[model samples]
Target: MQRYFVAPEQFRGVIITITGEDAHHAARVMRMKPDDQIIVCDGVSRSVRAVVLEASPQEIRAEAEEELLQDSEPAWSITIAQGLPKADKMELVIQKGTEIGASSFVPFESERVIVQYDGKKEAKRIERWSKIAKEAAEQAHRHRIPSIQPVQSWRQMLTLIGEFDLALFCYEREGAAAHGKGIANAVRQWKLEREKSSDEVVQNPRIVLLVGPEGGFSEREAVEAEAAGAILVGLGKRILRTETAGLVGLTCLLYESGAMEGA
Candidate 1:
């Protein structure tokens, strides 16, 4: 079935009003008409099955047929704190990362980062990335759209580290032995701790995984990150590009948390 994202205000009682570009797509692109069954979500956590009651050039109104309980969201919330890569690599990262179930993305300026985010162009860049994430989420059947945060400076990035339950820096220099626990083991340990502290109920534990740009992080930056409660861990012996590293770290995290299963 086709799916559309509706704002919270658009949903009134049992009716869902889809306007703007989504309405245009439904009326023209999808060729949807009255009585067509579709799914509408609030773009956060709520979604429902609906049938179009009316379709016009200006809007499309649908009546809720039934509420849907979507369990596609991951058990843990994973945020990718990526160092700004050159050109369009950041777009590719956000697109694929959303499909892999990352909760949000934060691109930051690192010592080795080459791309510069000018004040005038920053909003447009963020808008473009947000669109990519939304489309990717819809295609992947995700209940919630992953957020695309504004680009941050090195110090700003450090300040945000305290928000997450765990912060990991994916450094190519340090091998898995840096923490005495590999990525897999570290995730398992976190999960075990979560289970033991049921009373505390760390539902949706937030994690921030940081990846550096092509040149990678400088020695000084790495030390500073480690000091700020970010664990330094290695992906593998083989080095990955800036875009590839974030996705790899997220895959390991989701798989370890039993959110993404392998055959």
Candidate 2:
């Protein structure tokens, strides 16, 4: 069945009014007609199975049939703090990261970052990235769309480190060796500790995974990250590219956290 996200206000009572691009996609592109079964999410956790009541150029209305649970979301709210890479690599990151279950993305300027985003270009870049995230979420059948934060400086990224329960600094060279703890081990420890807590406690823990740019983080930045309480860890033996590290690490993190096994 086809799925699209709509605003909570649109889902008034038993009716779901899909407007804007989604409506256009259904009515014009897909050529959906009345009685066509589809799913609509409220951009939150709530989703309902609905049958199309009307399809037009302006809007598509559907009659709600049943409320369904959003079972695809991971237990851990994973956020990727990606270093600004060159070209269209960031788009690939946002697209695959959304599919891999990242809740949000934060693109920051790193010490080794060569690309710069400023003025109107920055705004347009973020807007494009946001759209990619939304499309990826919809294609993946995600209940909630992942957010793309505006680009920030390296120091600015540090200030947000304390917001997460765990902040993984993706350093392939010296991080794991210096910390003496691999990514898998850290995840294992987190899980074991969480299991010891009460059921109602620590319901949804937040995690931040930070990956550097093409040139990667400098030694000074690595030291600063360590001081900021960011856990330094390596993905594996072979070094992964900036674009690949976040997704690979996220996959391992989700699998280890029991998210890939399903709730």
Instruction: Tell me each candidate's TM-score.
Output: 0.93, 0.94
Runs in model 1 lying further than 4 Å from the true structure: 176-181, 192-201
lDDT of 2 by residue, 152-244 (tens): 788899999988988988887744465556788877887787778776557688999999999988888889998998988888767788999
Judge candidate 1 at residue 92 and give its lDDT: 97
- Looking at model 2, residue 10 earns an lDDT score of 92
lDDT by candidate, in order shown: 0.88, 0.88
Prediction 2 global C-alpha lDDT: 0.88
Candidate 1 local lDDT, 1-263, one digit each (tens): 88888789999989999998889988999999999999889986689999999997689999999999888888889999999999999999999999999999999998888876687998999999988998888888888888988889999998899889998888887654544446776677767877787478677789999999999999898889888988887888777988999999999998887886753
Clashes of 1: 0
Clashes of 2: 0
At residue 148, give the lDDT of candidate 2: 90
